[model samples]
Target: MKIITLTFFSALAISVCSLIGPTSRAATGIGDECNKGGDVKFAIREYDNKLVSVCRADGVGDCLYTKAFGKTFVDNRLHLNSDRLHDYVIKDLSGSYGDNDVTHFMLFAQCRDGNFVKVGDDFFTNLRPDAMDRTTGWLKLRVTRDCYNDSISDTQERSYTIVFDPKKRRYGPPDSNPKLTHYCSDAELALPVGSANSSR
Candidate 1:
């Protein structure tokens, strides 16, 4: 078993779900917490704050992945709907299907009272900067059916620029975004392609 750790300082901006009277919110830089795991492990930790995320391996193969006992954490901040506070994006290992393993990306937002809360459902899979962008405070997620494992199949991808509405207290166009693109490739998916048993 091995462990990896990352430490850095960054300021995040995000806001809450409920519409309450505004309070003084600080644009503070949060910290990360992480733990150890399998053949390979990854964690992001901060020296000051209490926030943390960890990913442990559950199964052994060409790639290390978490299943029932496995967990992965991320601490990327996004300015979803507001400028005072920042939203957070996290990644997790959901589960597996046959020879394939699945991961999920979740979004968390802070409220007017200075508390963080989950904004929506598990809305993304294999989420990354290559497939999504949050630089403008609006999210442009290039959606695709994930093929993270060795399994490859016919798939289509789309790109959507989702905006958060403060008046409505929600991200707009809850349904699938407009703009269908092309099929998915192995390199685009960022995982090894072909059968699992095939020699690397």
Candidate 2:
């Protein structure tokens, strides 16, 4: 009887180990890490007499912050939306198109809470000068597509405007000055695209 009991207990332990082994050994993918808020870090600083902040990885990795407005934190820079305030804007290179020798551009904005959030999509071609209209609180950006193409480089230019809504403490939908002529590649776009709506 005792041998039978011991055998039963050993079988239970083996079954439990079998159940836990695969789960423990399974690799953690990006989606899994992102859902858990991963390993991003955020820091706040003072820029233009306003509190500014950035959320990035400890090492070079994907950014996880999003959202804007109010006293909420999201990506890089944070600020409140008010006419008396200047929105923090960041222009940076996303990455290169592998060996294609093409670089991409990305735009980021600061929310009232001192976190920076990305604006619009990646621009593939030549980007005209970016400007912020202080009077109307509108940000204007223009970009040309396929400027590097060898055959007559059919460069199509498009402009976009982003407006801030102080009441809602957020920016309105992005509007294009000239509608897109060609479809931009969705591949290799930035991560954490939209607002996470997180207070953190």
Candidate 3:
């Protein structure tokens, strides 16, 4: 019985050692760790100071996202009549949304010039770009619909004016012209970024 116990212990040690390999034994079987699973969502809201279009971009809030816990069930989401991507690029384009508890994100972009490319990893966070010009990079942006171990929140509604620098070939907020002090300010839930009656 003593010999048998010794052999059993040795076999257990060998089994653990075998799992340390690179590819084949990364982790498998009942004792292995599982990857966190969840979905990611992003919503974009844009508007002037009137607070008409400052609705929930995500089911909870505006055009925003995160790499962690997502929005709650108590969200006052935006009610949309269509899922169609309208005016893929708009000036004063800023919004917010929740992360839904996930890690790892990639943003894909499609320009009006038909140039499609991915924005790589984790480039957006508490991000409120001042403006968007179709001629520039903000024509279209995409987010990971699925995620792993992440969290996020939303952006408010305000006037976000974007302009394109033809020579610089870039987009940015102006120093003072139509200064977007409250680009996404005073945003409430369950409102749409269009007409007041349109917001739910």
Candidate 4:
């Protein structure tokens, strides 16, 4: 009886340790310790083995950090360019003028000195990874103009191709072909679906 009881206790201890180990580690995930103000919330994930934290200010729409991530800017759209030795973040920005908001996009590349350099900045409607050439450092973006203002002129949507120039260490100028205009509604241009409503 003594031998059986000791064996049972040993197995129970091993089981308990196994359950607690992973839970404790997961509870301490990267960026989980960062101090987010009362009005802000952050979601943390691992991209290319680095902690990527998406922080929202005022718990509302299109905060500056969110726009610096991408059009979708959510966890699903976050990507890492591992092909290049250094990591880079490509995102968009917006500003308010009276009742109108203007949005623009940019690219920031991490330098060897552990600082980021803004490599590209321009007006763009939407951006997404170009799967066909992402391994080669290419991206697909929707081009538009005056889409945010009250005026409806230059709201046409066009497709543009952008490539990363490793030698110059910056994204090259966009290449676009003249095409028929496609107008996008405000809802279509708004933040990614369910982003503003997400609890996280």
* Tens digit per residue, CA lDDT, model 4, 1-200: 99999999999999999998765543332123223222123332234523243433234565345333543222123222332324334333334333323344545433333333444555455555554343433344333333442454334333445655545444554442112112234543332322322111
Q: Which ten residues in a row have the lowest lDDT in candidate 1?
A: 30-39
Per-candidate count of clashing residue pairs (backbone under 3 Å): 9, 12, 30, 0
The C-alpha RMSD of each candidate to the native structure, in angstroms, is: 17.8, 17.8, 20.8, 16.0
- Please name the candidate that would achieve the greatest lDDT relative to the true structure: 4
Candidate 3 weakest lDDT stretch, 10 residues: 74-83
Q: After TM-score superposition, what is the CA distance of residue 1 in candidate 2 from its true location, in Å? A: 99
Largest TM-score belongs to which candidate? 1
Those runs of model 1 whose alpha carbons end farther than 4 Å from true positions after fitting are 1-70, 97-102, 126-140, 147-158, 161-168, 172-200
Residue 1, model 3: Cα distance from true site in angstroms: 99
- lDDT: which is higher, 3 or 4? 4
In order, candidate lDDTs are: 0.36, 0.36, 0.27, 0.40
Per-model TM against the reference:
0.39, 0.34, 0.18, 0.36
**True-structure RMSD for candidate 1:** 17.8
Model 3 lDDT per residue over 1-200, tens place: 99999999999998877775443332121112111121122333323331212122235644333212232111112111011112222112122323322222222222223222222233122223333233332322221122112223433232222333324323333222222222221221222332212221
Candidate 4 clash figure, as a count: 0
Candidate 3 C-alpha RMSD relative to the actual structure = 20.8
Worst 10-residue stretch by lDDT in candidate 2?
191-200
Model 2 quality (TM-score): 0.34
Q: Candidate 4: lDDT of 162?
A: 60
